[model samples]
Target: MAHYARRRCRSACAGKEVSLMKKVHVIGGGLAGPEAALQAAAAGCEVTLYEMRPHRSTEAHQTSDFAELVCSNSLKSESENTAPWLLKQEMRRAGSFLLKEADATAVPAGHALAVDRVEFSRRVAEAIAANPRITVVREEVISLDESGDHITVLATGPLTSPALAAELQRLTGSDQLAFYDSIAPIVDASSIDMEKVYFAARWDKGTADYINCPFTKEEYDTFLDALLTSEKVELKEWEKGQYFEACLPIDELARRGRDTLRFGPMKPAGLTNPKTGRWPYACVQLRQENLRADSYNLVGFQNHIKYGDQAKVLRLIPGLENAKFLRYGQIHRNTYINSPAVLNGTLQLKAHPSIVIAGQLSGVEGYTESIAGGLLGGRFAALLARGEEPVAPPRQSAHGSLLHYITHAEAKHFQPANITFDLLVPLEEELRKKIRDKKERHRLQCERALEAWGAWLAQSALPVG
Candidate 1:
């Protein structure tokens, strides 16, 4: 999920920014909506944040709090050389409110920004409640009209309610609203066979935060055979979009090769079974999905297989034979308009400038990426409301790469994306420096990004005190 952080600095701007006292409506109170609300409120816009909970609920959320995380608790890595770490650093420099809160409540997880889910959600709810400029409405919005006098931002997230989804379809003049995003299963920690699974992080990097279930040559072959032959859930008529590679189900991975599992999610890198003192032939690593540490999710194991087949076939792993599933893998239709065809870099829909779409609903994936999208989009919407010039981060920046990817990616093949160095513009020719080390090269890229981003922020003339 998306998160924010803040750096304290003395105020530098000396002019009064335009005030948008007029009310702005932000639909959905997940990561994106709240970020949008916070940004707009900070810009002097009176934001009405709508969240459908308590009275109405989604399948994934168990609480009424805003910005709930339905999956893993860790926010990936915090190493500056990593792409995610650079992204977080960029967000903090951009004055991201959500990141500020996340950093404030972060828990130790080696180099990851893990948090107590209960405390995180509660803090988010309290922050929004305390913002006098934001009015939290616990009502589900069925639909929105583009003809309205005020702007509306739809950050409804992946599990958008059916009624509002239908309304969105009507507004877009297309039958594109979708439901059913299948998540991978989480396993009960007590059930895993500790003797068979080893604790290690990839490349001996970071901390021993993962439990890896290894497979030998013979066992991997059998598992592949079972995965390929296992029955899969039939797709519905409207649920026909091709699965994104990052989230490809195990069955699909199996079809790629007899040895694909060994190379893909089950790769036996940076791990050695204590018994043999050697890396296993293949492996499946389970990461903590909650702060309680009572459960772990099968990393890279999202699937659309029949639930029964999942239990029967997945248990073939050496450590998962008696696994008790906290959640089952299943596939559902996800819907999004061709963002390149519908939205600008600022996330404004092309045909209607007053409307913006954020989060997974806009074809961006992962939690933090979605939050970054909202935070940036919110700033743009605030600029639009105040009639100020819109700002875009330099292409060298992570935020700019994401904005460019969603707005300029080939519409026909558009898929959800996570912020990565590959998506950013190539480094300067003069600065190539003939570096061969990947980590050192990444450090150079990040250094360039920070300098460019600082220049961009300092040059942008925002009307703020």
Candidate 2:
């Protein structure tokens, strides 16, 4: 399937006369940047991919590699007929370079498409470097001139450099919206109490890849109290208190309510505890960090607490009492624009059509969604460079649903979104009534989405496998 997609992409560009003047300047070496560059190059545009890494670094990245994953290695779920899975399927059909690289470096993550971060980045960088039409420049792009001849894709992601971010603020005439994004801590797998933590994927959907720490009512209560009282990393006066709802700090989750954690991350709805043969009061899941399985990340336990306090509070979990921390949870600023106010459905800037925005900086969250933005932004930029009208994916498709959400969401309450069934256009009234079951409705939605996506690909200039 992947090979066919690549062949189609190459065929789409074959014999096309690419104007030397119609170059695509892609900023950032992150997931979106590389994807954008690859797509543009595949569309017969000369692409200059700029990376600040090795010359400049961000708060989260530890390497100079392209598309280095900072927060988590997992790219959410790969469960079939789900929104995320549907989006990935579309990317696969469209020949998303990053998605193919992710597949090549996948680790054992049950139904989730998790990859080895180092290898994933390495493969992405290698591919970008090998592309003849794509030239990688290692330097920071501090400002963008909207009047420049080249089409620019601003895919700097959430950790865009301050100078560039400020320039973007001036260009959009609105300060970038920001929120605290937290990273989950990773622990040495050997330190965990194997007897206390059992392996199970929720509902046994796939091979048991998750390490589940079951908690009794008393144990959960004790842990909650400790988390609530633990000292947190103090934010600067200016960085005081906004957080993305999807990736809230564990400490903040505890502050919401004692049961919030139980209902959110620690929910024990699925999988019977091997020891008790029933659901526990609560549970903490640990996902393997890499293919080696030497480390496991505290799933959805992103926090900004002091290191000492974090260790103390986390060890309260049943299996991690003597856990050895591989990496401590930390918080960083996630910068994004008010997409509804600044972007169009094609991801082109409202004020300057020459500049396109992609990734988290464009207000879509999650790894695959960011890549989706890059896919569209690159394609749109290519079409514009070729003096052709840019087309959006079908509204019923995951790609179009995400693009629509970012560009048409209520500007007053705009927040970044991950692809969810709620974001897609609702099912027809008759279908909804006939299919009363929610999962069945979603399955039908996925079916409609793929059908619409197939028609869109067939009609549009986009490469189809």
Candidate 3:
């Protein structure tokens, strides 16, 4: 299908230079769109990147900045020999623009790669704005042009606006492609009762970057009681049970059991209470919000509780007493398509090869995965615009594994996923038998994936890192 489109584009643009004949239109300036724009420009395509902010705002977005990290600043585990680390390694090999900026604005978050959200977005926006081959448009793209005049990359992350979503549904005849995602609250550093909190990383793994708020059994029980009864923001009928498993709300965890939060987000398994000289019964870890380190967000505290009641409940955490909230936790709808049904291996809409689907909208989850999707969409669209065939990343690589799952998973039961060792193609029986330790197996898989990715990058029509 993509071949036919490539042939048509080649004939239509016949003698004209490929770069001059086409422009790539990337919609949504979230984590994915800017990457797509920058990547397409890097591939010698003229690009128009659209962002609907500072003009029309969404429920969770607070600024006009591009590539904002809305829910969590942390981009999952960065420990070597891990799935998330493999995915990032692949993007770095491909010269991902967003990942480069993320590294520049990184903050100390122990083993995970967390960044100063404000600085990260600012750097990305500056890069997009300064690119000579790209133009930025500050408006929502409610409708798309599929006439093959140009290539379009839809990368509007999880919080894709309603109108555009409806238009997308109209174009593709898709339904039941949304879920409710919650945001965690940020507290002013000055307001925290730090005497009750101490800095420590779990197990002393990487430096003491996290602020640990220790809680006694009595305090945890009291907090649980308040949390279980907190009035939550109501969701529409369709959004009732659609929360993604990895990002469920704090209150929802409370409903599972009396000890769920203690074992889950509030686990104190490895953290020691310095003053008491032992781990507390429970804990709430707060992560720095920005490079300035003036505020911290409650780790794993995404919630849908009503603001008035929510504040009271969250303050029950030991050190959060008298906490002043800079932002309150809330829920918003996250939109995504059934990629297995609608998109091809290269992230192109099957019905419209000129359009590339990406980000959460393309059914992958997490911040890092979204940027990786953008890299694929941008490269595919750029190659297609230049009347060349878009090559799929080798299935052994992390990038290819994600695209493969999204484009080939069982459509009816598919859900957006984050990178995991399980998602990467499993090892052959011989290798699995040889590597008895699971960590060793994972490390080997990540190594092979990088080698495959490196070989693929070497053969690309354009140069990559």
What are the models' TM-scores? 0.87, 0.94, 0.95
Q: Arrange candidates, best lDDT first.
A: 2, 3, 1
Model 1 steric clash total:
11
Q: Model 1 — TM-score against the truth? A: 0.87
Q: Give the per-residue lDDT digits (tens) of candidate 1, residues 201-236.
A: 777667777888888888888887888888888776
The lowest-lDDT stretch of 10 consecutive residues in candidate 1 is 1-10
Which ten contiguous residues of candidate 2 have the minimum total lDDT? Answer: 1-10
1 or 3, greater by TM-score: 3
Cα-based lDDT at residue 279, candidate 3:
95
Clashes of 3: 0
| Cα misplacement distance, residue 316 of candidate 1 (Å) | 2.5
Q: Pick by TM-score: which candidate is best?
A: 3
lDDT of each residue in 238-260, candidate 2, tens digit only = 58578999999888888988899
Q: Write the per-residue lDDT of candidate 3 for residues 350-458, one digit (tens) a residue.
A: 8888889889899998899999999999999898888787899999999999889999999998899888877788889998888899988888899899999999889
Candidate 2 matches the true fold with a TM-score of: 0.94
lDDT of each: 0.76, 0.88, 0.88
Runs in model 2 deviating more than 4 A are 1-21
Candidate 3 off by > 4 Å:
1-20, 236-238
